[model samples]
Target chain A: MRKSTIIVLALFAALFLAGISAGEPERVLDQAIRICLSCIGIG
Target chain B: MMERVRRLVQVVFTFLTNGYWAFPFSRNIYQGPLKAICSPGLNCYSCPASTTYCPIGAIQQLMAGLRMSLEMGQLYLGWYVVGSIGVLGGLFGRMVCGWLCPFGMIQELLHRIPGRKFDAIPGLLRYLKFAVLALMVVALPLFAVDEFGAGDPWFCKYLCPAGTLEAGIPMILLQPDLRHTLGWLYVNKIFFLVLFVVWSVFANRPFCRTTCPLGAFYGLFSRVKMVRLSLDEERCTECRACHQVCPMGVRFNENPVDTNCITCLRCQKACPYGAIHLEAGGVRLGARQSRPAQAQSS
Candidate 1:
């Protein structure tokens, strides 16, 4: 309800849309689909 | 009722996020369509059954490839993960930590094993998670690139107990070939994993309080999060009942918007008066109505 909270929420929502349009989630997916060797303490 | 519902939600989220049923047969992690979405909680992507990616792990991976991503003319390198986290954080803040985090549920369950319990951890240690989010999650992955122009997921490799428990142990147990690769790194990770597991039995959410980078990241939005706790100072009796029930050591009467608060609302349940309320997007969810004192947890 406050101005600052509304601003912060709107800002993040915009960033989310931009990120999606830029195909950034696909970039994240490329790494995530594989078994992260370092995450499992290997490689 | 709130506590019981929280536990059920935690269980459901844990199952839904890690519901890939082919792991036992394939002896490998799920590489499915759901991997693209980053879950708000701290479930390891490398876990054989995990359907969604862990947000911290995804961000670190993106940051680690900053050099390569830029070289490939990728203008938006880490915005997806950052924005996703921001959206979730701005909505509920550390409510993800309290309700959806499988690791948080594990820690809480461990603490309930009926042993000599400590009220809280050292207050100074509470700041360590912030340092971890800055250093291990952000700074190291962005700046500490290798000769080949790629960095490492430093936190996952060196410090994440969730990864060790959910991914490393299971993968090694299933593959068996991975056992040959086990060395000091695995031993070191296991040490911290065991340390936190035992520590959780004696204290409430020690890892969340002192070391979880994801919790720290969400905590940043506590002040602005749509879903939050509001304290009616005039009606509050200063009885310290809220403090007694807070699993994360947040004293709501003193500071309703404390960064460490998970917005679990146990404090609201504990209060004798209707001084605390849960608000979501300016709408009162609950906690204003008076309840019997017997409903409060000891």
Candidate 2:
């Protein structure tokens, strides 16, 4: 693999790990559970 | 022969992703762990049978949440959605559009319904998708807040013919209450959907070329994606046959890694010199032989 590609991959991995640690999966679930009226342009 | 295979694969994928066959009146949205994960393509989250979340919708929600967190004195990010998009885009680029997107397949099928075909938009107009990604998906949700500190999903609300087709129409048909609440916005969306359907019959992937923000996002990774189309200059005869078959109108000879190229591999099949092939992680997938000269003459 190219050095640049490797560097980009490592950076993405670090970001992904950081996001996993910080994100509250529960909150995402709460949002996902209900249909957002605005999402369908109803509200 | 290759075209048939592509169409077959598309049909199979469409059926598999949207396999939930319940009564049309049922308003149940699947609330499983799969709903938490993003689908590889642009399936609407509100679709009654959708097994997964739409990545674009998820990201907009996350961005809206970011604005709310600003007032709460804490930060909240939808890292899972971002990571999923990054990983998927980096791996396959816009291959998802060609192979997986139900909407893309729908448009292709619509185009096949014998009509006057023409290029609906200029080549340079393809840049509109990027503006949509930046403004509607990112900026509007981040800044356009409501009294409750939540931002509207602008793209889904105002645009997104897919949402109009999959969710709005179905929900209206199912729920009497929703039908009672119909207004100009709903009518406007329906009008747009009709226009898109008409345009697709005449133009090749007008939405994919001009309006799809997801395609624009994935196209960004085409240059460095792990799996990509590579052209062999030595073997290439510059016959321009690939150009004729490309639905996206990408000039593969000039740039095999053109962001617009959907990696559909039609060009690979069309190449008479056996110059184009798909490569994944440095391994060649196949070397298809060129069609015989007599076949071309015939």
Q: Estimated TM-score per prediction?
A: 0.96, 0.91
Q: Going through the candidates in order, what is chain B's TM-score?
A: 0.96, 0.92
The list of candidate 2 runs beyond 4 A from truth reads A3-5, B23-26, B70-74, B288-298
lDDT of 2 at B153: 84
- Measured on C-alpha atoms, candidate 2 has an lDDT of 0.79
Candidate 1 docking class = medium
Weakest 10 consecutive residues, lDDT, candidate 1 chain B?
Answer: B289-298
Q: What digit string (tens of lDDT, one per residue) describes model 1 on residues B42-69?
A: 9999999999999899888988988988
DockQ-based CAPRI category assigned to the predicted complex of candidate 2: medium
Cα displacement (angstroms), candidate 1, residue B153, comes to 0.7
